[model samples]
Target: MHIVVCIKQVPDSAQIRVHPVTNTIMRQGVPAIVNPYDLFALEEALRLKDKFGGKVTMLCMGPPQAEDALKKCISFGADDAVLVTDRSFAGADTLATSYALAAAIRQIGKEQKVDIVFTGKQTIDGDTAQVGPGIAKRLGLQLLTYVSRIADLDLEKDTITVERRAEGGVQVLQTAVPCLITMLEGTNEMRFAPLENMIHAARYPVRKWNKEAAGIEDVTKIGLKGSPTVVSKVFGPTPRAEKALMQSVEDATPRDVSLNVIQKIFTQHPTLERDILAKASV
Candidate 1:
């Protein structure tokens, strides 16, 4: 079984800055980290590999510096790492990203047969939750999203069973191999890397691929040109002027404090007091 995990290197949200003039995210001087959600997917894939005794490949689409993210996955037990970085892939939206990633997966299939593909529920930067289904559609694979647990895998039968999160309850789903799964966060914890694996990951020669190498043939379907959505501006929510009022009852008795709060509520909203009295009569 060959499992492919797609990951992204994103700016640390805590350290991210917005360009004052352009109203864009300023990635310069911001520390980069693997999308936290993607780590859950990687950990689940690694667990599968541990049980099935097959190879797990980590794939990413980002700048050259994203190689570090791939190396981190290697330390967590990924068998191979591939970085697909190119100027042509800059400013890609979810649609274009899926196109490029599906193309790269095709290229990887030529080298090894891929039985499953895993991705995060969503990225912190782009929380659209569209890429996984888009990649599945493009690749003609089964699509499963918000998976909480992988219950079973039948290698001989080429089928997988998983528990998917739904509106009210969990959905137990069975699907064929070569499916795409977007793992939900908090499903599994990432494992610690061994000392030897950490050393190996630091020295690992990660494969780097450009647009051509990643098997993207059409120039019109990648990068800024391929993206349909345009961001006019990015800004944080405005802070409200009036702060919330706090009630202090440190020295007062509980009953007195409760009565004080009730009186204040009635004073603030006379209609609320009348409505409460009317309801109490029932």
Candidate 2:
């Protein structure tokens, strides 16, 4: 029942700023923090470890600074932490990232049989929601996304049931071991690290793996060369020149205000009323 939880260190989006001239993200003064969504995944994994009494490993692929993020997970009670960092893995998109991470997971599997892999539903910076599924496809593991809860687990039978949040309701699905799950945010809260754990995390020797160590043989399959998606440009939304028109309800009755709003809408968009009537007739 060994669980591997993947996390990423990302810039605090609240403090992120865009360059005025280049329109690129200004990361110079921004503080880095663990991806919020990944915290839920970590907490869920920790919960399972508390119940099942198995090891939980934290994995991340980023620059050397990302080791801090792994240490943070260690303080939260993960048994081990692995940092896969190499210059060759720089500028990787979701595809290349998944390839590197999948390769690294294969290497980790050699040391210990990984029963389950957990990740966040999406990264805040990218928000593509593709890496988890990509890793699952690359590793041929069962894919579960938007998981709200772990309903049941039977170690003897190698079966696990989970509650997945779907469009309208939750779907309870069971799958075998060696599966990948992308946990939905707000499903669980991260626990506070005890003083001993914090001290241990600070002194823990985080295992560092480069591309060669992470089992990446093909140089072309990682980093920028493997990334197919290209951003043509990045720009902020155009600012509106006119301010919104304000309706004063202080001097008007509710009925009068309602009529005034509808009248204004029709007045501004002359064809809106006609279009509504036309659609209603159909």
Candidate 2 C-alpha lDDT tens digits along 102-126? 9999999999999999999998888
The per-model lDDT (C-alpha) reads 0.94, 0.93
- Show where candidate 2 strays beyond 4 Å: 239-266, 270-282
Q: List the residue pairs that clash in candidate 1.
A: none
Clash pairs, candidate 2, are none
RMSD in order of candidates? 4.0, 4.3
RMSD of 2: 4.3
lDDT of 2: 0.93
Q: Write the per-residue lDDT of candidate 1 for residues 41-123, one digit (tens) a residue.
A: 99999999889888999999999999999999999899999999999999999989999999999999999999999999999
